[model samples]
Target: MLANADHVMPDELKFEGDKAFFFAALDRADLIVHGRNSYEDQPNSPKRRRIIVTRKVGAVARDTENPNATLWNPHGAAFEAARAQAGVHTGTVAIIGGPDVFDMFMDRYDTFFLSQAPRVRLPGGEPCFDGVPARSPEQVLAAHGLKAAESIILDPAFDVSVTAWRRDNASSAARR
Candidate 1:
């Protein structure tokens, strides 16, 4: 996927609302790409084109139930190659991740959707992004020219929706 997302379940996501929408979107994706850790988190399941990006695993046998699943390592190139591959095969792509993966491709991402659970806090756990010092998700996206496009207050679960600043703006791209 040409985008990044971080979700805080229950609060930012609800079993009935946000989570339902999240998985439904995933189901509709032509390519579901995720980091190694995220891949491990999921119960091997079928439905979409699942691609796990990691250098550590080399490759793993496709989950019997999910024959469409496969794995590929971005191999230090971030996801240029993987993106190309996905483009050739499918139009829709989704990226689920660990921080390093997200940071690496955040700038080029066409959209970024973050589900923040306000008021609640985690004492100590994995960060949403790795290798970089603490930076608010909004700041990072702003630096990449991804401004908030939409925000929804879904009662039990309030989620902020963000898409690319503008889908076709070549000028907005942070030219290297």
Candidate 2:
């Protein structure tokens, strides 16, 4: 499990099919969003533009290290502003997770891709979403108004499957 908040992904959690699916989606995205803690060094990661959610800055700021990355604090500035800062005008936005970051965008997500690894269990490990272990990721997504679509098996060997939980826009509109 995690020795700290940003420990490397353990071998048990790695899924070849999931990685392929995720990176393919990311390749189609114009902008990517994730928390500082979830920063992963992919083969062409720096080549992809992204917005890094962090409290280190009060508002949107240019990432000193990566020219393609922008640091944003959702509390201080609007997402559109951050998007512009990240040079993403029109395209898909891929959100990589680390619990708190996913929670921040929970309400706005149109479709949440959930990959379940049934065999992998970490009693005290960090959850994919907040209030996990007790509430479960599915519960949290359902609580946030998302309904699962169809389950796609990523890896039959590992029994890893992914489901796209779509937000009910009609119900959301009524709630608003």
Candidate 3:
């Protein structure tokens, strides 16, 4: 799943790196799972493929112009269903998320790819990952069942770093 913490009204579609990562991950899956907030925040564009998982069945509509996307609730069973679907592929199944959704699925995800903002600050907006206290993003991921798998510094212009983690299944102490 591709995600970022930005102002709610911000056009995240314009974020080149985030959007590029999102699309790249999308190409690996025939299905995409997203939270309601992220789903509702979608911009009008063609060639978008998505599925919205919400509490209500058919609670929202897909943009009329976005022919490739579909909406569904999965009644909070999106994880199981997505797992079933993704099991067919040895590739990845991303859980692109807003905070609530991330909080819900973080422990269950096999891995997480986080794009960290070292010094960037926002005025008023929800966080990228909720309930995680202010600390190094790496430390936060370690608190979950994740261990740093890779790290990359893209353009210095963005002041952002990309970090990847795979679930730590080795030991009980590894549940960070």
- For model 3, the stretches where C-alpha displacement exceeds 4 angstroms are 1-15, 39-49, 58-78, 82-91, 133-136, 169-176
Q: CA lDDT, every prediction? A: 0.54, 0.83, 0.57
lDDT of 1 at 33: 75
Output the worst ten-in-a-row residue range by lDDT, candidate 3: 39-48
Best by lDDT: 2
Residues 31-98, model 2: lDDT tens digits? 88988777556797999999999998999999999999999998899989999988788867888866
Clash count in backbone of candidate 2: 0
Per-residue lDDT tens digits for candidate 1, residues 16-64, read 4545556766766677777765642334345456766666544343434
RMSD of each predicted structure: 5.6, 2.5, 5.6
- Stretch of 10 with least lDDT, candidate 1: 1-10
TM-score ranking, high to low: 2, 1, 3
Error of 1 at 70 (Å): 2.2
What would the per-residue lDDT of candidate 3 be over residues 112-173, giving only the tens digit for each residue?
A: 88886555555454666764446555676678768988777654677666777887566433
Which 10-residue window of candidate 2 scores lowest in summed lDDT?
1-10
